[model samples]
Target chain A: MNKKSMYGRTARKIGCYAALLILAVIFMFPLYWFFLNSFKSYEQLFQFPPKFWVWPFRLVNYLEAYMYPAFDFGQMMKNSAIITITSVIGAVLSSSVVAFGFSRIRWRGRDQVFVLVILTMIIPTEIVLTPLYLIYSKLGLLNTWFPVIAPFFFAKPFYTFMLRQSMMGIPVEMDESAIVDGCNVWQRFTHIILPQVKPTVLAVVIMAMQDQWNNYLEPLIFINSNSKQTISVGLTFFSGMNATEWNLVFAGAVMVALPILIIFVFFQKYFIQGVVVSGVKG
Target chain B: MKKYTVKEKRAIRQGLLFISPWLAGVIGFTLIPLLLAFGISLTDYNFLTKPRFVGLENYITMFAKDPLIWKSLGITFLYAIISVPLQLVFGFLLANLLNQKLKGIVAFRTLFYAPCLVAVVSSTLLWKQMLETEFGIINYLLGLIGIGKVSWLGQTGTIIASVVFISLWQSGKMIIINLSGLQAIPTAYYEAADLDGCSRWRQVFYITLPMMSPTIFMNLLIGLIGAFKTFTQIKILTDGGPSNASLVYMLYIYKTAFTNYKLGYANAMSILLFVIVGILTVFVFRTSNKWVHYGSE
Candidate 1:
C-alpha cells in the first residue's frame, strides 16, 4: 500500500512539472520565433522545415533594415521618447493634482464631479474618433503631436482613480499636522501627498509610457506626414508592398520592445506593486 | 495672522483654482469631444460633406437595416467572451503556480510579460509570418509532431482562434496582476484549511478562490473592455480577412469611417458600442457584489 501511494505521488509531481513546462513553452514560442527570424537571411526565411536555429547567422539584415531608412532609427527612437516622456509627465502631474482634490477637498458638487469623471471611463475612444478628428482638423492640430499630447492634460479617469486610492491610504493626520504648521494646500500637496503617493505616481508614469509608446491608431489617424510619424505609426513602413520583410520586421520589433522590456526587468517590483495598488481601487 | 471667515472661503477657492488646468482639459477635450461625437452621430456627417441634421437616420440604419453591424457586434462579443475567460483562467493558474516562492520568479514573470511590450507592428508582422501556411514555424512544429498542416490565419474557422492565441501570448501583465492578487491573500486562511484536513482542491475552492474574487472580477472587467477595443491586431494581421471571418466591431467601425467614408454610420456604430460596453460593465459590476470579498469585511 505504501509503495502504491508513493507511485501516485510521484505521478502527480511529474504531471505538475509537465503542465508547467508545456505552458512556459507555449508562452515563450513567439519571442523565440521573433529572435530566430530576426537573425535569418531573407532567403532562409521561407525555407522548409523552417530553420529552427538561424545557424550561419547573418547580421546584414539588421544593418540593411536600419541603414535603408537613412538611419531614422535614431530619430524614430527620439520621437517616441519625446512623446512618451512628455505624456508621462503630463499624466502624472495632472492626475495627481486631480486626485489630491478628490481625496482631500470637501466641497459641493465634488462627488458629482467625481462620478462624471468615472463616467468618462466607459466612453469608447472610437465613439469620439470622428468628431475628435474633425475638431482636431479644424483646430489645425492634425499631423502634429498636439492631438496626441493634449489628452494627457486631462486628469485621466483611470489614473485619477488610482491616485485617489493611493492618497486615501495615507493617514489624514499628516495633512492636518502640515496644515496646522502653516503649510497651505499646495505646499501640503507638493510635500505630503506627493511623497506618500510616489509609488502610485511612478506606476502611473510607467503605465503612461507603455500606453504612449505603443499608441498606434492615434498616430495613424492623425499624422499624414512621414516626418511626424511616431515609431508605432512608422512601423507600418515595414510592411512592404509585395512582401512583408520578415527579417527586418523582426529586427524593428526587437528594437522597439527591448527598451521597455529592459526597464521592466529592473523595476519588476515597483511595476507589480503599481498594478496591485491601482487595480485594488481601479 | 487673519482668522477671517472670508479668508477660509478664499483658501477653498484657491484650491479649486489650482485644479482649473485639469478642469479645462476635462471640459475642452474629453467631455466636449464626447458630446460632439454624440451630436455628430445623429447627423449625416461625413468629413468631406457638411453634417446635415438627419435626425436618427444613422441610428435607424444601424439598428434596423445593417446586418453587418449586428454581425460585427456578435463577433466582438464572441471574441471577448472566449478570450477574457481564457485569459482569466490561464492567468489565475499561472499566478497560483508562480506564487510558490520559487527561484527565478521575476525572470519568468518578465518573460511572460515581454510579449505585450513588443512593438505592435513588429509583433503583428511576426505573428503574420508565424501564421503563414507554408513557411510558418507553427505548422513546421505541427509536422514534427505528425499532425497535419493547419492554416491558422487562412481558414475562416481558425482565424479567430489565431487572433485569440496571439492575444493570450501577450497576457503577461494580467498574469502578473493575478500573481500579486494571489500573494495579497493571507496565508493563514489556507493554513487553517489545511489544519481542518481540507483537501488541496477544497482549500482552493473555499479559501483561495473566495479571497481572490475581487481581483478576478477586476480582471474580467478589464479583459472585456480591452478585448472590445481590439483593432490594431486585426488591422495588421488579418485586415478582417479570410472572408471577413475575424472582423470585430471596432475594426468594422474603423473601416466604415475610413475605408467606406461612412462617418455617420461609424459614429452610430460607435454609440451602439458605447451602450453595449456600458451595459456590460454595469452588469458585471452589479454582479461583482455577489462574489467579490472585501478583506476588512
Candidate 2:
C-alpha cells in the first residue's frame, strides 16, 4: 500500500511537469514562429510547409526594413524615445506628488477630491477625445508631441490611484517622526514616503514607459508628418504600403518589439509587479 | 463651523498645493471635455466650419434615423459579452495551473506573458499574416488536417472570432492578476482541508474558488470595460471589414469623428456609449455584494 501511494505521488508530479511544459510550448509558439519568420527571405515566406528554420539568416531584412526609405524608421524610433522618456518622467513626478497628497497629508475635503480622481478613471477617453482634438488644434498643438506627452505631466488618474494605494500602506508614524524633527511636508515626503515606496515608483516608471512606447492611436491621430511619427504608427504605415512583403513586415515588427522585450526580460520583477497592481486597480 | 488651527490650515493649503496638477487635469481634461461633448452633441459642426446650433438634431438622428447604429451596437455588445468572460475564465484557469509549486515555474510564467510584451500593431500584424488564406500558417495547419482554406479575416462570420482569438495572445495581464490573487489565498485553509482527508478537487471547489471570487469579479468588470474600448486590434486587423460585420462602437465613433469628419455626430454617439458603459459598470458593482466573497465573512 505504501509503494502504491508512492507510485501515485510520482505519477502526479511527472504529469504536472508534462502539462506545464506542453502549455509553455503552445504559448511560446506564436512568438517563436514570428521570430523565425523575421529571418526568412521574401520568396521563402510564401512557400507552403513553412520553413521551421532558416539557414544563413537574412540579417539584411533588418537593415532593409530599418533603412526603408518610405517610413523613415530611424526618425520614428527617435520620436518614440523622446515621447516615451518625457512621459515616463512626467508620470513618475506628478503621480507621486499627487498620490502623496492623497495618502500622507491630512486636509479638508481630501477624500472627496480623491473620489473625484477615481471618477475621472471611469469616464472613457472618447468623451474627451473629440473636444481635446478640437481644443489642441485651436491651441495650434496639432501634429505636435505636446498633445500626446502633456497628459502624463497632469497626474494621470490611473497612475495616481495606483501610487496612492501603495502610499497609504506605509504607516503615518513614519511621517510623524520626520514632522517632529521640523521637517516640512516636502522633506518628509522625499525622505519618508518616496524611499519607502521605491518598488512602486519603479513600477510606475516601467508602466509609463510601456504605455507610452506602445501607444498607437494617440500618435496616429495627433501626429501627421512621417518625420514626427512614433514607431507604432510608423509600422502601420510600413505594412500598409508593403502588405505583400511579408519579410519586411516581420523585420519591422521585430525591431519595434525587441527593445521592450529586452527591458521586460531584465526587469521581469517590475513588469509583473506593475502588471499585477495596475491590472487590479486599472 | 469651528475655527481652524494653524496646523489644520497649513495641512489644507499644502494638500491643495500638492494636488494642484490633478485639479488642473480634472478641469482641463475631464470636466471641460465632458461639458463640450454634451454641448457638441446639440450642434452641427465640422472641424473647418463654424458651429451651427442644431437643437437636438445629432441625438435625434442617432436615436431615430441612423441605419447602422443598432447593428454596430449589437456587434460591440456581442464582442464584449463573449470575449471578456471567455478571457476571464481562460486566464483564471491558466493562473491556477501555473500556481503550482514546481521548480522553474517562474520561467514558464514569463514565457506565457512574453506575447504581451509585443506592441499592439506588431502582434496584430503577425496574427493577420498568420490568418492569411493561402500563405498563412493557420490555414496551412488546417490544410494538414484535410480541411480547406478558411478566410479568417475576409468572412463576416469569422472576423469577430479572429480578433477575439488574437486578443487571447495578450491575456498575460489577466493571468498575472489572477495568479497574484491565487497567491494571496492563505495556504492554511488548504492545509486544513488536506488534514480533513478532502480530495484535491473538493479542496479546490470549496476553498480555492470562494477565495478567488473577488478577483474574478474585478476581472469581469475591468475586462468588459477594456473589451468595450478595443480599437487598435480591430482597426489594424480587419478595419470592420466584409460589410461591416465587426464594426465595434469605438471604431465607428472614430470613423465618424476622424474619417467622416462628423465631429458632432461622433460626440453624440460617444455620449450614448458612455451611458451604456456607465450603467453597466454601476450595475456590476451594485450586484457585487451578492457574488463577490471579500473574505470578511
Candidate 3:
C-alpha cells in the first residue's frame, strides 16, 4: 500500500510538471512568434505552412524598423526614456512624502482624506479625459511631455496608497526615536522612514517606470508632432504606415517591449511584490 | 475641546506640509477635472466650438434614443462577465500549480508571468497577426488537426471571444497575486486535515477555497472593472470591427470623443459608465460579506 501511494504521488508530480510546461509554451507563444518573425525576410514571413525557422536571418529588419521615416525610432526612444525617468522619480518621491504624512504623522482628518485618495483609484480616467484635454490645451501644454509627465510631480493615489501601507507596517517608535534625537519631520522622513521602506519605494519606481514607458493613449492625445512621440505611439504609427511590412512591424514591437522586459527580468522580485501588494490590498 | 499645545500645533502644521502635494493634486487634477467633466456633460461642446449650455440633453439622448449606448454596454458587460471569471479560474489554477514545492518552480513562475510584461500594443498586434483567417499559424495548425479554418477575429460571434482569449493570455499578474494568497495560507490547516484522513481534493475544496475567498473576490472586482475599460487591444485589433461586435464601453466613449468629435456626448457616456461601475463595485462589496471569509471569523 505504501509503495503504491508513493508511485501515485510521483505520477501526480510528473503530470503537474507536464501541464505547467504546456501552459508555459502557450503563455509565451506570442512573444516567441514575435521574436522569430522579427528576423524573417518578407518572402519567408508570408510563406505558406508558416516557416517556424528561416535561413539567412534578416538582421536589417531591426535597422529598417529603427530608421523608418514616418516615425524616428531613435528620437522616440529618447523621448520615452526622459519622460519615464523623470515621471517615475517625481511619482515615487512625491507619493512617498504624502504616504509618510498618512502613515507617520498623527493629524486630525488624516484618515478621512486618505479615504478620498483611495476613492480616486475607482474613478475611471475616461470620465476626466476630456476636461483634462481641455485643461492641457488651454495651458498651452499640448504637443508637449508636460501633459504626460507633470502630473507625477503631484501624488498619484495608487502609489501613495501602496507606500502608505508599507510605511504603516514600520513601527511608529522609529519616528518617535528620531524626534527625540533632534530630527524634525523632514529629517525623520528622509533619514529614518525612507530607508526602512526602500523596497516598497523600489517597487513603486519600477511600476511607475513600466506604466510611463508603455503609456500610449496620453501620448497619442498630447503629442501631436512626430518628433515628440514616445515609443508606444511611435510604434503604432510605424505599424499603421507600414501595414503590410510584417517584419518591420514585429521589429518595432520587439523594440518597444525591450526596455520594460529587461527591467522586469532584472527586478522580478520588486515587480512581483508590487503586483501582489496592489492585489492583496483589494 | 482642550486647548492646543505648541507641540501639537507644530505637528499638525508639519503633517499638512508633508501631504500638500497630494492636497494640491486632489484639488487641481482630480476634483477640478471631475467638476469640469460634469459641466461638460451638460453642454453641447466640440473642440472647435465653444461649449454651450444644453442641460441634460446629452444624458436624455443617451438613455432615451441611443441604441449604440445599449449595444456597447451589452458588449462591455459580456466582455466583463466572460473574461473576469475565465481569468480568475485560470489564474487560480496556475497559481495552485505554481504553489507546489518542486524543483525549478521559480523558472516556471517566470515563464508563466513573462507574458504579462509584454506591452499592450505589442501583444495586440502579435495576436492580430496570429488570429488572421488566412496565412495565420493558428488556422494552419487547426487545419492540420483535421479542423477547418476559424475566423478568430473576423466574425461577430467570435470577435468578443477572441478578445477574451487574448485578455486571458495575460493573466500572469492575477496568477502572481493568487500565488501570494496561496502562500499566505497556513500549512497547519492542511496538516490537520491530513491527520483526519481527508483527501487532497477535499482539503482543497474546504480549506483552500474558504481561505482564498477574499483574494478571489478582490480579483473578481478588479477584473470586472479592468475588462470593462479594455481599450487599446480592441482599438488596435478590430477597432470595433465586424459591425461593432467588440466595441467595449471605453472604446465607444473614445470613438465618440476623439473620432467623432462629440466631447459632450462622450462625457455623458463616461458619467453613465462611472455610475454603472460605481453601482457594481458597491454591489460586490455588499455581497462580499456572504462569501468572503475574514480571519477573525
lDDT of each: 0.78, 0.84, 0.83
- Which candidate number has the best DockQ? 3
Give candidate 3's total backbone clashes.
Answer: 0
Over B33-141, each residue of candidate 3 has an lDDT whose tens digit, in order, gives 8888888999999899889999999999999999989988998888888888889998889899998889988788877887766777788888887877877888888
lDDT of 1 by residue, A121-194 (tens): 65566567777888889989998998888788777777777787778778889989998999988899899889
User: How would you encode candidate 2's per-residue C-alpha lDDT over A1-282 as one tens digit per residue?
Assistant: 479768977888788889888888777888988898789998888788777788989989999889887878999999999999999999999999999999899899898889788667667775578888988898999999998998899999878877887787788788888988999889988988998777778767877887899899888888899989899888876655436567888898898888888887998876566545433432
Clashing residue pairs for model 1: none
Quote the positional error of residue A80 for candidate 3 in Å. Answer: 0.7
Candidate 2's clash total is 0
Residue A154 miss distance in model 3 (angstroms): 3.0
lDDT (tens digit, per residue) of candidate 2 on B14-74: 9999999988988888788888888988888888889889989998899899978988888
Tell me how each candidate scores on DockQ against the true complex.
0.47, 0.57, 0.58
Model 3, A1-282: lDDT tens per residue?
Answer: 489889988999999999988988888777788899899887777777898888678999999998887777899999999999999999998999999999899887788878778667666676677789999999998999998997798988878877887787788789888878999888998999998877778778876887788888888877899888898877777555335677888888888788888887888776666545443443
Model 2, native contacts kept: 0.59
TM-score to true structure, per model: 0.90, 0.93, 0.93
Better of 1 and 3 by lDDT: 3
